[model samples]
Target: MGSGPTAVEIISHLNSSWQKVRGYQTETEVAEYRNGKLQITKSFLYSFRKPRDFRIDMHHPHRGTSLICCDAEGKILVRPGGIGAVFKKRLSPDNRLLADPSGQRIDQTDLGLLIRNIGHSLTDQRRGDMKVTDEGGRLVVESVASDHFLPGVLTRYRFVIEKGTWLPAQVVELTPEGVLKRVVTFGTVNLLSDFPPGFFISDREDRGGGGR
Candidate 1:
């Protein structure tokens, strides 16, 4: 607390940790709600490779196969056939709408990217408000005043990163005044030697052009 790693150091450590994980696949469970109502819970199986290429498959409540893929060209392919049809959209890295079902933009499965975003935001300003510490062998980081939060909501985030793996175990979203909001948990993660070709593409090659 009083004497610990600086924000920069914490960021550097997190970045290094992610570098060790060349590729991985895991199941992530997300529980989210808005304005004290409209709560929903869903699970996604995510697989990722370096430098912004990944695939997410939606499970349950929604029938059929729904998939989202992000390519190196910054294009997002959404196959909403379960809910609707397939579409492609060009969006920035931080686009909130990119998060399906849960509606929260933060990449719930990729803790490293989330930490990188937070680190980028906390640079050169009042960094003293943020703190990094260790709890029960896991590294914990918290920012009292952070802009890296859910839109329209003033909340602070606490990320619990596994010390050895450098991957996130859980993310806790809380109100500025410290009331709980959402909790996202990452399930058992398994490293992959390589991502197979077409792993990040829509199953139906014929599916084309923006929204159903």
Candidate 2:
């Protein structure tokens, strides 16, 4: 029998799919952790559009909702009770709001970027830090980052890409000490050819708790 697709091959397919996608929306369950124990889990509705535009609606049952939107113009963060604020900045991978706990500026939850990183890990194998394995019926690609690159924290990111969709089912972030930092599980994904007008715009300007 022949070996199935390599990590690099799967990522190539994923990257090709991303190039043609105009936009996508998905429901995600985000879990934050510390010291290897489970912390809390939150649900979010995430949407992304081409040419740098994204929105996140974090659900808080009693407290309401938190909305974060980024586009070519700037970022808008809205608090639960209708208070929101806007900042002027173009949407890019370097945006501070998109920075992860390790100070790496990336859309940590993006499937496209996650797939691309798998390719990067394979390309630059100097550290021997990447591995591909089969786990829980998904293809798992794990990449480890050294402290030299990230300054302080030595981190590992794991991507579990589903076979059928070629999209990530879950993403895990672990610290140097093997502490589980965060895990995000993706739910239903909807690829959209057209979105509503001003869907990325926010009108709330509340300054409570630095919404974003």
Query: lDDT per prediction?
Result: 0.63, 0.62
Q: Give the TM-score of candidate 1.
A: 0.73
Model 1 ranges with Cα > 4 A deviation: 2-4, 35-38, 71-73, 80-109, 120-128, 131-133, 149-154, 207-212
Candidate 2 local accuracy as lDDT? 0.62
Residue pair clashes in candidate 2 = 83-206, 84-204, 84-205, 84-206
Q: Which pairs of residues collide in model 1?
A: none
Name the weakest run of 10 consecutive residues (lDDT summed) in model 2. Answer: 82-91
For residue 159, model 1's alpha carbon misses the true position, in angstroms, by: 1.0
- Tens digits of per-residue lDDT, candidate 1, 1-212, equal 43567777777877887778777888877777565443877788877876556777777545344445464445556555443653444444455555454344533446556766656544642334766777866877776444454444445667777877767778777667766667777887788768776676544553344432
TM of each candidate vs. truth: 0.73, 0.72
TM-score of 2: 0.72
lDDT for each residue of candidate 2 in 1-212, tens digit (9 for 90 to 100): 12456656866877877787788999888777768777677787888887556677767432345454563435445434444223323334555655655454434446666556556544553144457776656778776754312554556777787766677788787874567888878987788887787677653333232323
